[model samples]
Target: MPGIGPSIAAHLDEIFKTGKSRHFEAVMKGLPKAMFDLMEIPGIGAKRAYRLTKELKIGSVAELEKAVKEGRIAKLEGFGEESQAEILKSIEDTKAKSKEKRHLLPYAEDIAHEIIEWMKREKLVARVDPLGSLRRKASTVGDIDLSAATKNPAKVIEHFTKYPNKKRVLEKGTRTASITLPSGVQVDLMVETPDAYGALLQHFTGSKHHNIALRNYALKKGLSLSDYGIKKKGTEDYLKFKDEESFYRFIGMDYIPPELREDTGEIEAAIDHKLPKLVELEDIKADLQIHSSFDIETSHDLGESSMEEIIQKASNLGYEYIAFTEHNPSRSKHNDQQIIDILKRKREVVDKINYELQNRSAHLRETSARHSEKIDQINYSLINMNKKNIQKARPQATGALATVGRVFNSLEIDIMPDGRLPVPEDGMKTLDFALISIHGSFRLSKDKMTERVLKAFDHPKVKIFAHPTGRKLGHREGVELDWPKIFDFCKKNNKWLEINADPMRLDLPDVLVREAVKLGVKLTLGTDSHHKDSMENMNYGVSVARRGWAGKDNIVNTRSLVEFLELLKG
Candidate 1:
């Protein structure tokens, strides 16, 4: 067997010597790195971890201590009742210190920005600045510190007290006030002269770690840092630094980026300016799949697929096109022939609307002939304007009206006893957009289930694999086929994955969606609505897509209908 790491080997050695070992490594591998570290201690495994985490609500080692002290472990599953008191007794036997402090400064930058903007607007602040841990860009901020060049901070402090959405006033004095926002953000206002503002900001922004490192480095160079100034210890005179950058330069360190001010080797990296650029939400475009009450059971109102309604709902969502993927014909009991006939009728309706609008010039002339001279002159003027304007306006109004017409159009279907009928296949492939989904036999093993879905993907007509996991919230866990493998196969085959928009079934969770995107798997947003009303779920799918960090390029549904058809060809 390969030698394990020192930590695991030592753990195994201790467990084996203590005669309290079973499936330790197996449990460790399944947990997250942070969670794994917590589980490595004696008496911690899948059962205990689950018990402590789920029932006792024990997250970190500190929480575990509380659970043990409270004797809550015995209440968890797989733990015997007698083990509860023993666990608490054991926790009492251990010695560990709990450090309680505000985790990070809260809303430091927002406070800084608000205060600076206010100072600039009010003219009381000659020169206002944000300093302290916020300027260092620490990951966690606890409070905001503002240094403004003002003769009187009374007005600024008073403004803060009267500020909208103020939650709590922590401290108040003539020149300073600390208050919490409704959002739990805390800010401290400090009034100072322009000459001392930089020193005050530098003092406030000190990361205790960075400060200590700087102090130790400075001490070696015969200097000390304080609110007054950086001064040589032996000499009372100041170091005479002009700005924050010069202060760091005098101390032999490069300027650090605010986001990296955690003293996590960021100071050293700042020497070389090696900060990695992080991607923001603005980089994303397009949300792939979503649904609208298109599923038969989900759209229980009519026991039928509402394509027109779906289209109108999609239009309302600002979507140019949407995949009207109903439940697969194989799973649905509805007559396929009837579905095809209905689609044919829908196509005719679309054609009629298109034809009426296409010949609107002639239609308008005819309709205008029946009106008075005033109406005739108005009609002639409208028609004679610009062809481009007429073309643009006609399509826009017709598209909206066409969508409304579809929403009101209803068709009924009764599935025969045989449960085998041909769904209408509209030969008019003008829409050229559809997604396929599975609706039966979810309780299968991974290999069998994956193979079943693979067949659906192999079908040329299936553009997207809808609700891949089929996990329904607060209900069934759904079949567990390996998602990485599924997403990989889909990427290789140019198939899109549906982020099913149902709140209960945001099937492709954000994490999985991110992984799928990394593998270049195209995503399709589907409301998966069975009825017109449920089509609102497209927004839900879009939200999930945004959560997944999906941009427009990664989404199949964001493309033109022509592009969608071309992608389906793949």
Candidate 2:
């Protein structure tokens, strides 16, 4: 404060008043606005935008597009043919995305989770529930809303105002608070008493239409609903609940999951006791698509663990099986024969590990039997002597041995532009399964893309489709295709589709997943993991499946190894 100047003090005051920095605008006045606008293009960073405007005299995207089309951008010092083409593609992608609404699902979920966790750590908070579209697991969220049950509302409000990531506090009060995060997304919090917390959560965690429908139903039952509680038609006495299950049951219906409370016949289904038992995270028994260090070379295909490490981790998670679907070597820097040989060796290694695990399990069984016999003899001696001071012999515990989970050798093969398999038939035969995927050429026409995918499905060896849509969140749009036809084809062909669990690519998204389930097509959940720790992303895929209303019966990986193998045989 000693060195504080009038200009700096004025800047700070302006920011506090207007929630924006006036000084930044004053500084940017020296540069052309077009230079800043050009920075919005995907591949054009600040430096590149400045260079384009200063050196090439290109101040607009249209002019940059013209330059790219005329081969002029390729002539620039730092730009090459590939960079120019990519820039053009980025321009097109930006234009396309501008017309779409909603932020990516994962981005919004992360921000909400961070805030909820921070709130839960406060001693005064009894419970914190993320509400609204986020709770429903929508593919994109408009804003974040959270409800908390706490008797000390004043303390909760103070804690929220002091959140480390807060850019600015919009409003603060004893019962409600609002703040804007650094990411420019606004978050609202409501604090209520424990007696009315369930009703408060239900009222706020709703689609507007769903809430309206529920209110109408309540009116018909001579009841009134509010955030605080439910009341009779002519009385102020509120019937409160501590949990959603009791709240729904009091209304003469089974509890509805947040994901299914979209006013899409779920209310009727609940009343009739016919709601599907939705798939849960614990229902998943395997990760059918994963990558490890055994895969071939690629800048983006870097893996942090070996096949054995992956198996151990999967086993620790109580999985009965896992598949090592490494990127096909044809896309890597390896020759076909070399890649095939490498896969064969990896298969042998996995088989040997499985054999050792089987032997260890057998040994444990034998050891347990001998221990039981000794304990029985000691008990008989104690009984015969009628001794009260007999010492009990304890059975020795087994050490931390790896679980006997089977590891299958598989490949994430590319679906060629013309819809043929990238790997040869002989190479495919050596693998346990083939995960077909479309890595590039995403701008193909809808009919062409659909036909291309259909042709790939025609291959007898291709058992599963990975990240079927090929969409990268906040970046690229997936190729267009007739999804119903694709779903029908998968159902008829006895093939499976993947719920790719990469945070950026939760493809075969919720809506498509629902359609696939209705068509009776089996689904597999894969983390599409590249690193050892990434296998944990299986939860995200499960969330997507739940949002789609998928049940355990619809997922292939939920089956045991023997059941899964039988399904694969079809």
Candidate 3:
């Protein structure tokens, strides 16, 4: 307690004075509190808010709006037309009441998939499909829209209304119903006959702009489009399809995936049949970042599952490799030597598993070869005994046996406020891989923050920048930096950026991902998972990559363990 310091003592003293932090109040005096509130908008961070207040004389949302409308904000440095538009949109979104009701993509998808599976099990529907932004894999969804093809609409509607999780029924009808789930998520269901399901699916699973563009395209083709079907311009006859593929084929275009149906040249790409092969969940061969109990007691530590459990889970997922990038112990109570010992133990476990796996594989191969040689001897003897018996004596070789996955010892090292790594270079050299990250000190200026990150990239042992932007959905904006410069540095250094797939922190958001891809910056998809079930969130990262038009080659973990190691060496 002797070294408790003035700040802590002041905080304790102020607890009795006003039951709050006097330190925080003093800090708040440096800038208008309203500017802090303005920073809550999606596109505005602390730096931008400070700039708006000091440079533009805007201290509140209203003043920001006024500045935007008067065309004054666009004249400021770094405030272009696009920035102004985004700020205005963010301001509007901040003020909008319904914006708070939107759910994160993974949460919405889970609920939607559960309802679809439940309805399928109940036998009340032949097919059920979630539509709208949820199906499009948007980062957040407003409402869950579903379309069902069923012979009995009334029964399906009744069952939906009576579903166990339903908090309330907004409306009920024979063919349609809306219900609010327990989590305050609203779901709307439309039941149609099998003949019209495709049309409904295509119509409802849309970004409005995409649909309008499709309609215009149809008109040019002398066809009329609707939720019912495609109809000839001067006739009542309509073309119906059983699936989206045929529906798109009818329009003389290739099928566009829901994720790419954003009216962002996807329609034109479909017509040209030139869409890039999007990366898939199966294309991912490993998870590059994960935490275990070894990572406990650190900031943002998700230390639930043990290292063995994580390895088992990765093996079960059929992953060829996984890196246990535990939090570096430099920031914790452990000394460097203790951390090194722990890592040594982890490596021993991994080595034992690998040794056993190799031995088993070798034994299987030897047994297979011995059997094959025996079969060959039998065939030879049969041929000598009688030519007709050779076919019976011959035996085919069994397929190669499966092997256990490889586990690597890695660490998620912190980039300190001054751009130095928390772990020493000696400690870092022992890691199979190092994922450098920013844990705090998010208020650095853009230039300073960019320099800090670029310095971290200069570390010879650092292989990846984990959750590079550090943004958390709906909570905080990431540190401001010149991302184009960062991307170029990464490309030149052969360093990787992580598409962290945690629902709250899908860092390297899609737009940045597209930019990174264009810069030839290699990407690694990490669930940043702390538990077994969270490993499945890898698909979220894959979704982000797909939205950015990244192919399998753009990702690093798609390679086998040997290939990945070789690439790391380069």
TM-score of every prediction relative to native: 0.41, 0.76, 0.75
Worst 10 residues of 1 by lDDT: 405-414
Candidate ordering by TM-score (highest first): 2, 3, 1
- Regions of candidate 2 where Cα sits further than 4 Å from its true position: 1-110, 298-300, 331-335, 368-404
Question: Per-residue lDDT for 1-570 in model 1, tens only?
Answer: 387888878778879798655667676565544343335445566656664565555555556666656656665666666776655555444321111112232334556677667667656667776666556433234556676666557776676666565555556677677665555455677765555555556666776776676677678878888755688777887654435676777766676534344455556655566533422223222223333333333212332434444554555555544434433333254455645554555556656654553475365455444544555566567778743444211212333432221111222211222222223435224233444454556667787777666765654444567776778755657676778778878877787787877667776776677778668898876555656666654555655565455667777756665575577676
Best by TM-score: 2
Leading candidate by lDDT = 2
**lDDT of candidate 3 over 332-441, digit per residue (tens):** 67776776665666666667767776787689778877877898887888789777834644344332343335777778888888898877556676777789898889
Candidate 2 lDDT, tens digit per residue, 1-570? Answer: 888799888888988999878678877877766686677678799889988898889856667887899999899998999999999999778645532446766787889889989998899999998898888877677767889998888999889878999765656777888776666577889989887898999989997778888888888999888888899888989999887887888888899899888787778888899998999888888998888887466424756798778877887777878888888775456667776676677777767877887787688777778888889898888879897867667665423333635778788888889898767666777888788899988988999999999998888878899999999887888889988889888988998999998878888888888888878989999999987788888888988898778999999999988999899898
The clash tally of candidate 2 reads 0
TM match of model 1 to true structure: 0.41
Q: Model 2 lDDT vs. the true structure? A: 0.82
Error of 1 at 327 (Å): 3.4
